[model samples]
Target: MANTPQSKKRARQNERRYAVNKARRSRIRTYLRKVEEAIAAGDKDAAAVALRAAQPELMRGVTKGVMHKNTVSRKLSRLSARVKALG
Candidate 1:
C-alpha cells in the first residue's frame, strides 16, 4: 500500500516507467509487424527495407531495458534470415 513516503515515490516512478516502457514495446512491435506484413506480402525488397528499419528500433528496445540483448539478437537473426530467403 506504499505507507512510507519513499515507497510512494517509488510507486509513482514505477508507474511512469511502466508507461514509457509499454510505449516503447508497442513501438517495437509495430516495427516488427511491418516486417512481418512485408514478408507475408512476398515483397523481398519491402521486407528487407522493413527489417532494416526495425533493426535499430529493436536494438533501442534492448538499450532502453524494454527487451533483452539476446532476445533482440535472435529476433534480428531470424527475421533477416526469412527476409533473405524471400529472394
Candidate 2:
C-alpha cells in the first residue's frame, strides 16, 4: 500500500522500530515479573534486589520511548512501596 518510495522506506523503518520496541517491552515485562515473583514468594531480600534491578530497566524503557515517564514513575513508586512494606 506504500506507493511512494518515501512511504515504502518509512514502512520498512517502522517495521524495524516495531521489532526493537517489542523486544524492549518484553524485556521490561520480564524484569517486572521477576520482582512480582519475588514479592509473591515473600522473600523481601530477593524482592528488593529484583526491584533494584528492574528500576533501571523500567527507566530505560522510558528513555527509549517504549514507555511514558509518568507511567514508569508510578510503577517504580508502587513497586518500591510494596518492597518496603515487605520489611
Candidate 3:
C-alpha cells in the first residue's frame, strides 16, 4: 500500500507504464511469431522481410526500456540465424 501522495502517484504511473510495456512486448512477440511462421514455411524471402520489419520494433523495445539491449541483440541474432538456415 502506498501511504504517501508521491508513492500513490508513482503507483499509478507504474501501472500505466506496465500496460504500455505489455502491449509493446506483445507487439514484438507477434512480429517474432511472423518471422517464425515464415521460416517454418521455408520461405526465406518472407522470413527476411519479417525480420526487417521486426528489427525496428525490437530495437524500439530497447529504446523504450521494455527490453534490454543485449536481450534484443541475442533475439535478433537467433532469428537471423534461423532465417539464414531457412534456405
* lDDT, model 2: 0.97
C-alpha RMSD by candidate, in order: 0.4, 0.4, 0.8
Model 1 agreement with the true structure over 30-55: per-residue lDDT tens digits: 99999999999999999999999999
Candidate 2, 7-54: lDDT as tens digits: 999999999999999999999999999999998999999999999999
- Runs of candidate 3 exceeding 4 Å displacement: none
TM-score of decoy 1: 0.99
* Overall lDDT per candidate, in order of appearance: 0.97, 0.97, 0.97
Those runs of model 1 whose alpha carbons end farther than 4 Å from true positions after fitting are none
Runs of candidate 2 with Cα error greater than 4 angstroms are: none
Clashing pairs in 3: none
